[model samples]
Target: MDVLTDLLQRSRARGAAFSHSTAHGAWGVRFPVGAQLAIHGILGGEAFAWTDDAGTSRHVLAGDIVLVRGSAEHFMAHSPGAETVSFLGHPSVGPPGGAQRMVFGEGPGSSTTFFCGAYTFVGDLCAGLLAGLPELTVVRPRSGSSLRATLDVFAGELLDDAPGQQALLDSLLDVVLVQALREQLAADVHAAPAWFRAMDDPTVGSALRAVHAEPARNWTVADLAAEASVSRAVLARRFTALLGVAPLAYVTDWRMALAREQLREGATSLAAIARSLGYASEFSFAAAFKRHHRMPPGRWRTASRRQAAGLASV
Candidate 1:
């Protein structure tokens, strides 16, 4: 798998609830801040979207897609400064495959049609992937692009209550997310993190794919260099130059990322985690992890779980 795909999968990214809403005249809705990512697609009409903490607001027209990241309460409305009520429950109009529209401001005026989706992700690796994006990303669709096509289908699906509409909508939302992300990352190469942009380089990109594909493998600079059919010195220089870390250091970092996730999961034993990450023994893995994180693996796991539990209780 490519780096992006691997990151998405490993992070366990999944769609939460979704809704199709329409508003006439002056209307606004405030979305709570929780989802790791939120997708707003303007099916028809126009609206303004902005985060509460961030002053960035964009006037989005039909066929426009907005991607919001981070835990910031955000709003969408006919105007940027319009008053908003909490978009509580995002209740649908009917049952599954039923009319999924939520209406606001019944008075006669210009109508705005849009769909909103929330996505939740697990693990810090997901943060690495998202770190490349700005707080708000807006993309205007091309007339015949795949994202446009997917959005069209998504809008149509909401209108039709098919046998498996929920499953279908969920899947279609995933497609739209991937397409929008690809478009944004491609259009703004400099804004993307160096490791992601590095995926474009023939030399470094090849090595990165190899490392992501089998991070458990004992990778030497020569092993990675061989993946790109380049000299060790050449590969090391290019990899370090692009990613700000040597190839093997990148490997260790990735492994540690995996380790933290597994540790947080609290199911895998230390020996198994060590073996899966290519450590010769649990002791060796613990030693390496301590060096990287400045805490023993067991202590780190306990602390992480405690922190998570504390947050969950709140």
Candidate 2:
């Protein structure tokens, strides 16, 4: 799959959120690594996010999407002078008043509102995609952009106690993430990373879309070249230059990613999944999975399921 699709899948698997009001007297809040990807959307009032990068602090306002990508230790408070607090029961802290932290929940008050969630990425494609980002990514929606409108809608939905609101909130979180990535790609015009640069190229973007759309297809370099409407040699060179991998290799990686997701869900048996992914047999799929994840399909699935269960308990 393309990097964006891979990221979206990983995000969905490992993401959660909590929403509540910041206590009026609450001071600084510190988030530590492995704490999860936390995103705060201001509903009313304002606060600043402070980090120790070079002993400096960055300030954000309402309507901005503040992403602590690495779970780096950072604090949020009503003012810079507020006393910092440690996260209770963990390394980070929330505002006072014992506000109930809801993973992807709605707030009950008019305090400065925030949505906190975390995502854990898997596979080399996702790792490479995230490596290019800053430790903390704060995306401020441009004026009149669709991103702003989408965030506004998210805020409104969070405020609204509608039926099935949790599912709606989850979908809105995905939109917010996609829009943030789009904004990041649009604003970056320099010699960007391979994934971002690939998306910007018409040929590479078409090729990526085709691969993501039909990852199980028996794809050859020539097939991707034809899809991009370019000669085979040209397609190969451009694809490698922009994506840091050959066309067929990229397709293989994407197929493996899909298989990983399928295995985690226990959606089908190994043989069925292998067949659906165009593998010759369960044996071949197991060998490939072992090569990629250093374990056979069955073992990987068990481990992944266990890990997922542990996360759920948290």
- TM-score result, candidate 1: 0.95
Query: For each candidate, what is the lDDT?
Result: 0.87, 0.68
TM-score of every prediction relative to native: 0.95, 0.75
User: Would you give me the overall lDDT of model 2?
Assistant: 0.68
Report how far off residue 102 is in candidate 2 (Å): 11
lDDT of 1 by residue, 159-278 (tens): 876688878888888898888988888888888878778999999999999989998999999999999999999999999999999899999999999999999999899999999999
Evaluate model 2: give its TM-score: 0.75
Q: List the candidate 2 regions with Cα displacement exceeding 4 Å.
A: 1-3, 14-17, 22-26, 31-35, 52-54, 86-115, 118-125, 189-193, 262-268, 286-314
What digit string (tens of lDDT, one per residue) describes model 2 on residues 65-87? 77766636766766664576555
- Those runs of model 1 whose alpha carbons end farther than 4 Å from true positions after fitting are 89-91, 97-99
